[model samples]
Target chain A: MQANRSRFLTIMLTLGLAFFYVPMILLVIYSFNYSKIVPVWGGWSLRWYRELFESAEVWSAVTLSLQIAFVNATFATMLGLLAGLAMVRFGRFRGRTLFGGMIVAPLVMPEVITGLSLLVFFISLNQLTGWPAERGFTTITIAHITFSMAYVAVTIQARLTGMGEDLEEAAADLGARPLKVLTAITIPRLTPALISGWLLAFTLSLDDLVIASFVTGPGSNTLPILIFSRIRTGLRPDINALATIVILVISICVAIAAILMFRQQRAEMRDQKMAEGADE
Target chain B: MTASNSVSATPWSDTDGQKPLVELRGVTKKFGDVTAVDNIDLDIYAGELFCLLGGSGCGKSTLLRMLAGFESLNSGSIKIDGVDMSDVPAYDRPTNMMFQSYALFPHMSVAKNIAFGLQQDRVPKNDIADRVQDILKLVELQDYGKRKPSQLSGGQRQRVALARALVKQPKLLLLDEPLAALDKKLRKHTQFELANIQEKVGVTFVVVTHDQEEAMTLSSRMAVMDAGRLQQIGTPTEVYEFPESRFVADFIGSANIFEGRVTEDGADHVRVQTDVCDVFIDHGQSVKEGGKIWVALRPEKIHITKSDTPVTGENQVSGVVDDIGYLGETSIYKILLPNDQIIDVTAPNQTRPMNRQHLITWEDKVNISWEPSSAMLLTS
Candidate 1:
C-alpha cells in the first residue's frame, strides 16, 4: 500500500505540473504553423516570426513595456530598500505594526481593485493639478511601482532581519564615521538582499497586464496590454509568436540568474569547509 | 579602623606616576527603568591592564560600553587622557572596542578589514597598504591576508579582529570578554599572547570577563562588581589576601567563613569567639565590645594532620576527616569540627608513600591549624 501511495503521489504531481504548462507549449507550437487555423498539422515555417519583427506597432509596444519596467523596477527597489532598512534597524513604535500591514496590503488585495483605485487617483490628481492630463507611460509606471514594491519590501526585510548588526559596530570601533560604516560594511553585506529585491520587482513589473491596461493611454500600450487586446480580437499567429518570444526571454534570464546564485552558494560552502579544515 | 582619617592618599607628582588615562566621576547609566551602571568613580592608570570582573548582569560590560562611548552616561562625567569624553560620539572618541563576537566583516578580506579604518580616514593608498601589512604581521596573519573571515578559524578570526581594532592605534582598547569564545586550551595560550601585545604596544587595555582566574592572571589592577555597583578595586594580591567584604572574598576564591563575636580588641589585632573555633584574626578593622563579626580563611592557609599538633603561635582545632579530593599538585581535605562545621584544608602533594595510614580517610580524626594573620575580618 505504501508503494502504491508513493506511485500515486508522484503521478499526481507530474499531472499538475503538465496541466500548468500544456497551454503555453501548445501556443508555442502553433506560432510556427503555416496554416492560419487551429489544431491542424501544417508544414512549419518562420513566417509568423518574420511578420512579428516587421510590425512597427508591435515593436513600439515592446519598447514602451521595456522602458516602463526598467523605470518601475529602479524606483520600486529604492523605496523597498529604504523601507526594509527602517523596519529592521529601528525599534517598533505606536502604529508601527499597522504601518507595516498597510505597506504590504497591495500584495494581497485584489488586482482589479488596485487598478481601479489607481485610475481614479490619477484622474483626481490631473483635475486638481493640471498635470498628467491623461493616463500614459508615467501613470502605468507609477501603478506598477506601487504594487510591485510590496514584494520587494518583504523579500528584502527577511534578509535584513537575519543579517547580524555586529559588522557595523566593528566598523565604527575601527574609527569609521557613521556614513562610512554604512557604505563600507552595511551596503556590502546587503548586496544579496538588494539583488533579490531588484529581481522580484522587475518580474512583477513585467507580468502586469490589468493595471497597465487601466492606466495606459492611446499610443502607450505595453506588451501585456497589447497581447490582451489581440486576444480579444481572436488568437492570431503574431500573438502566439510574441508569447513564445516572451517565454524564451524570461527563461533565459531566470536560468542565468539561478546559475549565478548557485555558484555563489558553492563558493560560500567551500570557504566554510576550508575554515573548518584549518581549525582541526 | 579608618586609617589616618583620610579618604584617599594624594600623590606628589601627577605626570611622574601619571594620572589614570581614563577617569570617571560618579558616572551612572540608566536604561529606561533599569539602572545598568550605578554611580561609579574610577581611575584607570596609563599602560596598565585593568579588568572588571563579575557575573552576568553585574554591569561590568555596561561600564565598559560606557567607556567605549557606545552608551551615554546618565549623570556625571568621563575623561580620557584628561580630556572629557561626554560629548564625543563613538566615531569621534579615541577609543576602540573588541566585541565579544569578534565582529569581523564577512565579505572583506583580512587585509581589507584591517585597512578599513585607515581608508575611512582618507589616508593615502600606499600608506594604507603598508599599515595593513604591518598589522597583519603583528597578528601573525601575514599569509592569510587575502582570505575572508569565513575562511579563517575561530582563533585566526579573533586575531584579525584584534589587528583591525589596533591598526589605528587608539589611546585605549576596550575588550568585552575577548577570550570567551575560544576553547580552554586556546584561551590559555591567547591570554598570554594578548598580555604580551599590550606590553609591546604600550597602550592601556581594559578587559571585561567573568572568569576570576583570567582576571587575576592578566590584570595589574582589577575591579570586582555586583548588581551594577563596584564592590572593590585593588591589585590581585590585595583582593585575594585581604578582601574588604564577604562578597569580594567569596567571589574571588573559595574561603571558609565563620560568624563570630569580638572577645578582645588590641592595638593591631583582634580575637573572635567563634562557634566552631575560637580563632584569632589579625585584620585591621575596628570592632567594638560585644560586636558581631566574620572571619574568612583561605583553604591553603590551613594545614591538616592526622593527629593533634601542639602549636604556640597559631590557632588549632581537632576534627574528623569528612572527605578528600586529590588534585595533582595539591590535596583538599574536609575536616568536620565538633560544632558540626566542615573546614577545608589544602595540603601540597609533595613526596609519596611517607606514611601509609595518614593518607586521609573519611571520618578519620584530624587537626587543622593556621597563622593568626591568615584570617581576614569582614564587618560588612
Candidate 2:
C-alpha cells in the first residue's frame, strides 16, 4: 500500500510539472513550425523567428520596454533604498508606521487601481503645472516606478532589518561621520539586496501591461502591451517565437545567477576550511 | 597621549591628574514611567577598565548608551574630558562604542568595514587604507580583510568590531557586553586581551555587562546597579570583601546570610544572636544597641570537621551533614542546624578516603565555624 501511494504521488508531481510546462513546450515546438497555425505542428522551420526579427513594431516596442524598465528600475530602487533605510533606522517619529504601510500598500493592492490612480494623479499634475501635457513614455515609466518601488522597498527592508546597527556604529567609531557610515558601511552592506531589488523592479516594469495601457500615449507601447494587442488580433506564430526567446533569456539569466551563487558558497567553504587548518 | 607607568591609579594621563575621561553628575534617564537610569553620579578616569555590572533592566545598558550619546539625559550633565556633552549628538560624540551584537557590516569586506569611519571623516584615500591596514594588523585580522562579515566566525567578527572602534582612537571607548557572545573559554581569553588593549591604548574603557565574573576579572573599578539606581561602585576586592548592602553582597558572589540581633558591640568586634547560632562580626562601621543586622559568611570561610577541637572563634555551630556536592576542586557540604537552617561549607578535595567505613555519612554531626573577621555586617 505504501509503495502504491508513493507511485501515485510521483505520477501526480510529474503530471503537475508537465501540466505547467506543456504549453511552453508546445510554444517552443511551434515557434519552429513551418505553418503559421499553432497546435498543429508542421515540419520544423524558423519562418516565425525570421518574421519576428523583421517586424519593426515588435523591435520598437521591445526597445521602448527596455528603456522604460531601466528608468523605472533605477528610480524605484533609489526611492526604495531611502524609504527602507528611513523605516528601519529612524523609526521613532509619529505616523512612521502609517507611512511605512503606505509605501508597501501597492504590493498588495490591485495593479488596475494603481494604474488608474497614477493616471489621474498625472493628469492633475499636468493641469496644475502646465507641464507634461502628453502622457506616454514618461507617464508609463512613472507609473511602473510607483508600483515597482513597493517590491524594492520590501526586499530592502528585510535586508536592513537583519543588517543590525553595529556596522554603522562600528564605522562611526572608526571615525566615519554619519554620511560616510551610510555610504561606506550601510550602502555597501545593502548592495546584494539593492541589486536584487533593481532586478525585481526591472522585471516587474517589463511585465507591466495594464498600467502601460492606462498611462501610455500613442507610439509608447511596451512589449507586453504589444504582445497582448497582437494576441487579440489573433494568435500569431511570431508571438510564440517572441515568447520562446523571452522564456529562454529569463531561464538562462536565472540559471547563471544560481551557478554563481553556488560557486560563491563552495569557495567560502574552502576558505573556511583553510582558516580552520591555520588555526589548528 | 602616553600613559605614566606609575602604579598610583594614574593609568591614563590627564593634565595635573585633575580631569577624568568621562564624568556623569546626577545623570538620570527616564522613559515615560520607567526610570532606566536614576540619578547616576560617576567619575571614570582615563585608562581604567570601568565596568557597569548589573542584571537585565538594571540600567547598566542605559548608562552606557547615555555615555555613547545615543540616549538623552533627563537630568544632570555628562562631561567628556571636561567638555559638557548635554546637547552633543551621537554622531558628534568623541567616544566610540562597541555594540553588544558586534555589528560588522555584512556586505563589505573586513577591511572596508574597518575603513568606513575614515571614509566618513573624509580622510584621504591613501591614509584610510594605511589606517585600515594598521587596525587589521592590530586585531590580527590582516589576512581576513577581504572576507565579508557573514564569512567570519563570532570571534573574528568581534575582533573586527574591536578594530573598527579602536581605529578611531576616540577619547573614550564603550563596550556593551563585549564578551557576552563568546563561549566561556573564549570569554576568559578575550577578557585579558581587552584589558591589554585598554592598557596599550591608554583610553578610558567603560564596559557594561551582567556577567559578574567578567566584571570582576576585567574591571579596575566596577559599579553594581539595581532597579535603575547605582548600588555600589568600588574595586572588585573592595566590593567583594566590604559590601555596603545585602544586594551588593548577594549579586557579586554567593554568601550565606543569617538574620541576627546585636547582643554585644565593641570597637572592632560585635556579637550578634541569631535564631540558630551566635555570630561575632568584625566591621569598621558602628552599630546601635539592640539593633537588628544581617551577618554574611562566604561558603569557603565556613570550615567543617567531624571532631570538635578546641576552637578559638567566637561563633560555632554543630549540625548534621545533609548533603555533599563534589565539585571539581572542592566538596560542598550542606549542614542542617537544629533550627532548620542549612549552612553550606566548601572544602578543598585534598584527601580521598579509601574505605567505605571512613566515608562521611548523611547524618554525621559536623562542626561549622568561621573567624569573627570573616563575617560581614549588612544593615537594612
Candidate 3:
C-alpha cells in the first residue's frame, strides 16, 4: 500500500510540474526556431534573437522598464520600510487603522480599479497644480511604487515582527539613541528582509501591465506595455525571443538568490553546531 | 513583640546614614486599568548588588525597567547619583541593562558589541579598542572577541551581554533575569561570576529575578515584590528567618504555617492556638490578643523523631508520617496530625541507610518539635 501511494504521488508531482513548466519550455524552444511562423519547427537558429536586438523600439522599452523598476524599487522599499516599522514597532497611533488599511488596500484592490483611480487622481492633480503636465515615465513609476510597496511592506512586516524589540531596547540601554539604534542595530539586522523586499518590488514593477497601461503616455513605453500592445495584433518570433531572454535572466537571478540564501542557512547551522560543541 | 524592635532585630543591611546611589520616590506605573507597579519607594546603596525578586507579573521587571529609564513613571521621580531622572532618556541615563534574552547584537563581533556603548559616547578609537579588550579579558572570552554572538554558546552569549552592558561603566547596571536562560549547573556558576564582577567593577547592580534561590545567593539585599507591591526588603537571612508577611514566608522557601488566633502577646514571646496544638513564637509582635495570626516554621527547623521517643519542647506536635521524599542530601517528611492538618518537615540525612529501611518510614508515627526561637509570628 505504501509503495502504491508513493507511486501515485510521484505521478501527480510530475504531472503538476509539467503543467507549469512545459509551456515555458516550449516557448523557449520555439525562440530558437528559424521559421517565420511560430508553430513551424525549422532548424535551430538565432534569427529571431538578432531581429529582436536590432529593434530600437524593443530596446527603448526595455530601457524604460529598467529605469522605472529601478526607481520604483528604491522608493517603494524606503516607503515600505517606514510603513513596516510603524506597524510593527510603533506601539499605537490615532490613525493607525486608517494608515494600515491604506497601506494594504493596494494589495487586495483590483488592478483595473487601482489604475483607473490613480489615473483620475493624477489628471485632477495636474489640472489643479499644472504639475506632471503629461503622464509618462514619472506617472508609471509613481503608480508602480504605490502597488509594489504593499508587497514590500508585507514582507518587511513579517521579518520585523519576528525580530523582537529586545535587541533595539538593548541597543538603547547600551547608550545608543533611537536614531542611532536604528542605524547601528535595526537596519543592519534587517538586511535580509530589505534585500528581498527590494527584489520583489523590482520584479513586480517590471511585470506590471494594467497599471502601466493606464498611467503610461507617449514616449514612455515599458517592456510589458509594448509586448502587450504587439500581442493584440499577433504573436511574433521577435517577441518570443525577447520573452526567452527575460525568462533566462529571471531564472539566473532566482538561482543566485537561492544559492545565497542556502549559503546563509548553512553558515547559521555551522555556527549553531559550534555553539553546541562549545557548550558541551 | 513590638514592630520597631523586630525591624532592628532582622539581619539585613541597614542603610541608616549612607547616601543611596539610586532612589525612587512614590514611583507608580499603570497600564490601562491595571497597576503594573504601585506606589513604591526604594533606596539602593552605592556599590550594592541589590535584587528585585518576584514571580511573573509581580512588577519586579517593570520596576527594573523604570530604573533603567526604559519606562516612564506615571507619577513619581527616580533619582540616580543625586540627579532627578524624570526627563532623562534611556540613552542619556547613566545606566545599562542586560536583557533577559541577552539581546546581543547578532551582526557584530564580541569586540564590536563591547565597544558599541563607547562608540555611542564618542570615545576615542584607541580607548574603545582598549576597553573592549579589557572587557573581553574580564569575561574570560579574550580569544572569542572576533566571534559573533551566534557563534557563541548560551553561557558565552550571556557573558557577552554582561560585557556589553558593563563595558559602558555606567553608574548603575540593571540585569533582568540575567542567568535565567542557562541550565541549572551553568546558572549556579554564572551567579557567583556575576556577583564577583559587580564587586570588581564597584557598580551598583539591580537585578530582577523570579527565582528565590537565585535572589538569595546573588544579592546582598533583595526586595520581594508581589501583586505590584513591595512585600519586604531585607537580606536573605532576614527574609528567610523572619518574613514580614505570610506571602514572604511561603514564597521564600518551604514553610509549615499554622493558622490560629493569638492567645498571648508578651514582650519576649507570643503564643497562638491552632487546630493541631498551641504554637509558641520566640519574638514578641504588635498583634493584639484574640486577633487572627499565623505561626510559620521553616521545614528544616523542625526536628523529627520516633513517636515513642520522649521529647519535651515548647513547640511540639505528634503525627504520623504521611510521605517521605528522599532528596540526595536531605529528606522531606509530610506529617499528618490528629486534627487532619499536614505539616512538612525536612531533615538532613547525615548517615546513609544500609538497608531499604529509612529512619522515618511512611505511615510511621513521629513527633515533630521546633524551638520557640525558630518559630515566626506573622499577622497581616
lDDT by residue (tens digit), candidate 1, B1-380 = 24432222322123345467789999998988988789999998777789999999999998998888877899989999999998988888888889899988888888988888888778999999999999889889898999989999999999988888888888999999999999999999999999999888877899999999899989988999998899999888889997999999999988999898988898877888887777786764577857998889899998777875533333788888888898868888988887889888888887674665447778877778888888888887
Model 3 residue pairs with clashes: B1-B284, B1-B285
Q: For residues A1-280, write the lDDT of model 1, one tens digit per residue.
A: 9999999999999999999999999989999988766467577988889999999989999898888889988899888877777777666677779878988899899999999999999888889998688778899999999988888788778887888677777787777787787788777888888877887788788789988888888788888888888889876888888989999998999899889989999998999998998783
Instruction: Report backbone clashes per prediction.
Output: 1, 3, 2
Give lDDT: candidate 2, residue A261.
99
Candidate 2 residues lying further than 4 Å off, grouped into runs, are B1-7, B10-17, B106-157, B308-314, B352-361
Question: What DockQ does each candidate score versus the true complex, computed on alpha carbons?
Answer: 0.64, 0.38, 0.86
Candidate 3 wrong stretches, greater than 4 Å:
B1-16, B309-313
User: What TM-score goes with each of the models?
Assistant: 0.88, 0.92, 0.96
**Per-residue lDDT for B1-380 in model 2, tens only?**
23554434643323465567688899999999999999988888877889999999999998998888778899999999899999877777889889899877666788887776666667899998999898888777888888877667778888988988888788888999999998888889989988988888887789999999999999999999999998998889989998999999889988888898988887777888887677876755588769999988888888778954433336787888899887757888888887898988888877776663435557787888888788888895
Candidate no. 3 TM-score = 0.96
Which one wins by DockQ: 2 or 3?
3
Best by lDDT: 3
Error of 1 at A195 (Å): 0.6
Candidate 1: residue B304 Cα off by (Å): 3.0
Chain A TM-score vs. truth, each candidate? 0.93, 0.97, 0.96
- By DockQ, is 1 or 2 better? 1
